[model samples]
Every structure is written in structure tokens, then in C-alpha cells.
Target: MDIPSNHSNHDALWLPFTANRQFRSTPRMLVSAHGMYYKDDRGHDVLDGCAGLWCVNAGHTRPRIVEAVQKTVATLDFAPAFQMGHPLAFEAADRVARLAPGNLNHVFFCNSGSEAGDSALKIALAYQRLRGEGTRTRLIGRERGYHGVGFGGISVGGISGNRKLYGTMLGGVDHLPHTLDLERNAFSRGQPEHGAELADALERIVTLHDASTIAAVIVEPMAGSTGVLPAPKGYLKRLRDICTKHGILLIFDEVITGFGRLGASFAAEKYGIVPDIMTVAKGITNGTVPMGANIVSDTVFDAFMQGPPEAIDLPHGYTYTAHPIACAAAIATLDTYAEEHLFERAAALTPYFEDAAHSLRGLPNVVDIRNEGLVAGIELAPRDAKTTRAYEIFDRAFHEGVLLRYTGDIVAVSPPLIVEKAEIDRIFETIGRLIRQVA
Candidate 1:
């Protein structure tokens, strides 16, 4: 493989989600990836503690997914999905629908998590309007939720930092108070025992806005980017009950939790809460190819089927919707997950992950620890004049042969499902040392 010629030319590339100038001076470069490690430009084998942004659920560079894309591009490089069809797309959608929750029988394809979220929101609103509930227009999100960076996503997303400088977002969006009770739930294992009442905040928002005005309430079943706050015990059930009674739609943004990340195929199944709609990306193609699905229940889907047989049902779709290559990639990814039983692997490894995560309990600056399945988060106390002790730990861990992710003061870890017990120990041990070093 040929490296890009402009090794020193950071000026030419405008990197996304990065501090461009700082990154140019101190760049982290990945030259290759294998199972559970990335070989950096300097040949350092850094263990993957975050599963390549929590998408490579089956580890990296699997032959099946690689071959599928190779075979697909050879046969058909592109297929116009507008008023046209392809077998791979149809087959992949069928496969995804079969695995998707409930009568989430319909699949609308897009390219990324942001697109999946925006598309799901649009589907909820459009379906409501089609059924003559046109007034149900407002979208309800929770504080601290990270629903991608698209216009519709940002509008509903409650991350003030992500939305503050973007100018006024889409109107009629409200947020339920976030469910982060660090005082009560700190260092608790798995789903914290407290804060189950947080779901009831939706009722307050609903009463204030009147349930009829809201099209859907979107949330991560376990908030990931806002620092891995798993939904409190029975909270998801309460949210479901409220949505059921109010005739409101509940949308789970399962982009991060989809596939085998949660030990179950989806967080919906793990929590046993059936949302009316769900948006998924990331693990769809093992993060090998970009793809997303806006999954709608049969009722919501049939709402669009009401008007006519030969007419266009939904007036929205991407030009690359159901791209053949993406479909091929998704199919092979599913095969890889099933053949290796990665979801069950995650379940089996949860206890080891939990122990390793909790081992950081006494480390300096380690304020709290959260763990679920193969994922863990260590919250760091702020350094003076800075709220980012975890960021320092992140950079330090990369240099110490481990890669970690940081959101604010929290360092998150979600190793590939294929991570072994020894690897798990290395992950937390390295993190523990890094935390002590920073403190």
C-alpha cells in the first residue's frame, strides 16, 4: 500500500472533528490495522481500546467483508437507487429487517449515523403528517445526547456545546433533562441502581408541550458520547410506557449500540424495550463501508402505504440509498458477526470487562467508573483551569501502546468484541497508570 505523498502537508487537508492547528503539529497517524491493534506511522502497535470509534465490532480487516466489497465493486461500481433497484440492496435490506426489532420491517438506507438519525426523524414526522396528525411536529431529545452533526440531528440533539455555535437550530425542539446522577450512581457497575425516575421527565415535557405536538422522543438507550451513562434500571421501560400511553413515538438512536456492542444485537433487545423507530449506523458494515438504516415499525410504515398503490410513498431518499457496495458490505458484516458469535462473546466477556474497569477505582484523578458489556468509562477530575484530564490521559495512552477515546472529562473504552482477557487487563492497567501519571 502506498502512503499518501503529502506526509508533511497537513495544510492541504481540512480534518473533521479535530483541532486542525494542534493536530498538524502533533498528529496521530495510523498506517495499518489488523485484529485488535493499529500500526501507527512509527510502527508502534497500539492496542485498540475503542474498537475504531466503536464500530469494528468484529475486529478489523476481516476477509469476508473485504471480499464482499471487492466482489461487489467488480460487478457493479454504482447503481442508481432513484426509481431503480438492485438485488444486493434488496437482499441486504431484507437481512437487516429480519434482524431489526419488532415490525421495524422497513429499512431506509443512507450513508452515515447522521443521515440515519435525520432520516428517522423525517420518517416519524412525515408518517405522522401522512396519517393527518400534521400538528405532531416537535422533536424531543434529552440533554447530553449526541445525535450526530446533521441539521436535523443537531436540532434535536441536546448537547449545548455541539449546538451552541451552530447558530439557531431547527425550531420546536425540546429536551428532557439528562440522566447523569454522578452523586448517586458514581462508580456503580453496569446500569446504575439510581435515577430510574429520569425517564419520567419526559412526562413533564409532554405535559408542558402536550403530547400531540411531539412527533418522537429520541435517545441513546445508553448514552455513549455524553460519557457512557447507561439508562437507569427500569427507566427505559418507563419511557416506553409513557410513550405508549401518550400516543407518541419513541426513537432509539442505536447507531453506537447496534450490532454486538451491547452483548445483544441491539440495546432495544438488551433492555427489552421496543421503540417505535430506531436509527442505526456505525456497525452496519463493520465500519468498513458507510451505511445507515432508518428502521420504522409496520404501523409507521403502513401509514405511508395508505395513500395509493402506484404513487411515491415517502418523498425522501438519498441518491446513494441502498448502494450496492454498501449492501454487499452489510451482508458480509452480518455474516461475520453471526459466524463468530460476537454478540455472545461480548456477553461472555462482560464480567472480565467489568472487573478490569473497576480496577481503576483507586487510580488518581479517577472520579468515577462505568461499565456495561465490553464498554467502560473512567471519569477524571478536572485539572485546574481545565475540564479535560481525560484528554491528557487519552493522548498519553496512545503513546503507551493503547488507544482510548475522551469526551470531556471521561475516557471511554470499548474494545473489539474479539478482545481477550489479557488484552482487557492491559487496557485498564495502561489506563490506570496513565490516570495516575496525569494526576
Candidate 2:
């Protein structure tokens, strides 16, 4: 294959969440992608094992999504989301509401997961005030949780690294203990058996701050960016009950687990519990055009509806709130999911995926293997007193024709729902082979 000449300088662009100096020296540039593979600048096909950071659930370059975006962009590129209206925007919101669980039938669109996180936080606060609970201003997040980079998200988020760089985020935020008990749950498939009682940490926070001061509690049903930490068994339900008993809204940051990453429509569906507010992005448009939405339950919506019929309900939104291009892409993406039955496909393949993930348990540097649905995390022992082993393994695997994502010391693999059994084997086999060679 002939290599495409890359003449552009990489100095101008500052990549997010990346080591700029280290990455500029040797960049891993993907020129294009299709189906389950990404073609690097060097013209090598790298199997996508992380679903392009857990967003591209419907594979890559789907013709339907592409055509819809192209057609919509030509017809109407930009549409104001403030007071004006567009047909596609309403259509997309209705489609998303249809897929959302329980009474989560109201949708507010934004541009990305970060915006969704911040938007959800604001909505929670606004709803509390609307309901005459103006004292409920505090937000609760769990340690090791990854919301996003926005001020509100970082405040409620518990990942220290994400929070430390920006001193003192939104005030009155407390955290519940994360439920990753490695001693009892390591190498476990699906939800772990231990740490369900960890949900009580929220109760402790409520007691300390008083329930009236707490507005909402946000968590990822399965924490994704924090290294694939699945919620402990009964933990989600217990949290749901607590939030209910205290009259605090529960928000699930489903940016990573939404749109069938969990072999169901959403983590809410998989766990059989409903959250008052849910934030979703990424797979909403199959990682095509950027889009995110905060889905609110009917109760929350009804609270806002009591004001004036023509008055502004919530004074928040993005200029590109429901961009026509994103709306088009999302509609097509939803169509693709329904027609392909990708959620059902992922459900059927979970057992095979689980077995393949756990098969790496005895690998040289692997300390733990956890799998749930199509998502898996292989925790590696650190090297040279640092978390370098998984990073090296990630680089090596990319060269070996597979792409993986490493967070801290965990290698997370969550392939597209359309992935085949052969592709699954190839991904783990490549990782397993390269892991054995790690020093």
C-alpha cells in the first residue's frame, strides 16, 4: 500500500488529555477508518478495540450516517437553538426520549459529554429551586468517578487528577467512596459481589450535610474513563433508594455506557433502575457529529412546566444546541442501531467476550481482569515504580495491529457492537501476545 504524504505540522494543535511534548515526537495518526478498523497514516489497518474511546458503538463510516450528515449540511448547516426551532432538532430529541428509560422523556441537547455533565448539574440545581427546595444546593459524586472537565463536572467529579489542576471547583460537593474493592472483586465478570454497602457512604454524606442541602447525586452506572469500574451488585439500586428517600435527584452519566455499550439500550436498562436525570453523548451519534443531551424525567419536566406557558423555562443552552448536522447524524445512527439490532447483538456476544477477557488473567503483568457486557479492563502491575506497563503495552498493541485505551494501569477494551467473534479474538490475541513480551 502506498503511504499518504503527511506534510502538515503538528505543532499548532494542542491535543486534549495528552502529553503534548511526548506525543508530538512520535504521533499515532489515523488517516481514516471504516467498519472495525482504522487506517493509520502509515497505511496499516489497526483493529479498533476501544470503540474509539467508547463512543463509536455502530462501527465507523456508516454510509447512512455519512449520507444524512452530508445531505443535512448542504440543506441547512447551522440553526439557532435559542428561541428558533428546527424540525430535525425536535425529531432527534423525540427519538432520544423514546430510547431513554422510565419517565426520562425530556431531552436538552448540547455539543459533547463535558457539556452534558455541566448541563445536567445545572438542570438538577434549577429543578430543585423550581420545586421549592432552594436549600438543596449541594452535589454528591463518588471518588474515582469521571464526569468531565467543565467546572460543574469537575466539582461533582471525584477523580483527583482532573480536579487538582483546577483548584477548588463548585463548592458544597461531597463524594461517596468508590466501589472498586480489588481484593474481593478483581477478575470478576459483570457486577462484583462485594461493596454493595458502599452505597451507604451517600447516607453518611447526607447525614453530615443534611439531606435538605443536597440537590442531586451523579454517578456513572459503570464508571468508564476511570478504568472500567463496574458498580457493585445492588449498589445502583441502593443508591437509587437513598436518593429517593432523601428527595435528591439521581443522575447517571451515561456518556460512555449509553446507546448499547452495556448490551442494552443503556445502563439504566441493564441495571433495572431509573435515574431522575441522565446525561448521554458519544454513541448518540455513533461518534460522528458531536452531540450530547441531558435527559430529564417527567417529574423534573413537570416542575419546570408550572411557570408561564410562553415564558423561558430553563435559561441554559448552547449556540449549537441541536445543530442540524448532529440531529441528522443522530437520527440516522438510531436507525442504524434499530435496524442492525446492535444492542441485541452485543447482548448475545457478552458471554464470549467475558470468556475472552478473563482468559488473560494469567498473562505476565496482568493483575486483574474485569468484564461486563462488551467492556473489559485488564489491570497490569506497574513497572519501575510507575504506571508505565499498560502504556507500553498500548503502544505495542497498536503496532501489532490493534488499538486499545490505557488509563492509569488499566487497559480497557470496548469494541463496537458490530464487532465479530473473529475480531474479538484478534483484539485480545494481539494484546495477550504483546503483554507477554512486556518487561
Best by lDDT, which number? 2
In model 1, pairs of residues that clash are: none
Q: Cα deviation in Å at residue 231, candidate 2?
A: 0.7
Candidate 2 residues lying further than 4 Å off, grouped into runs, are 1-8, 385-387
Local distance difference test scores for all models? 0.89, 0.92
Q: Residue-wise lDDT of candidate 1 within 1-439, one digit each (tens)?
A: 9777755677888998777887888899999999999999999999999999989888899999999999999999999988899999989988888888777888889999999889889998997788788999999998999889999998888888888888999999998888888889999899989987988999899889998898988999988988898888999999999989987899999999999888998999898888989999989998998899988899989888875688998888888898889999999999999999999999999988998899889888788999888888888887675437888888888987899999888999999999999999999888888787778
Q: Which runs of model 1 end up more than 4 angstroms from their true locations?
A: 1-8, 385-387
- lDDT for 327 (candidate 1): 95
* lDDT value for model 2: 0.92
Tens-place lDDT digits, model 2, residues 96-134: 999988999999999999999999999999999998999
lDDT of prediction 1: 0.89
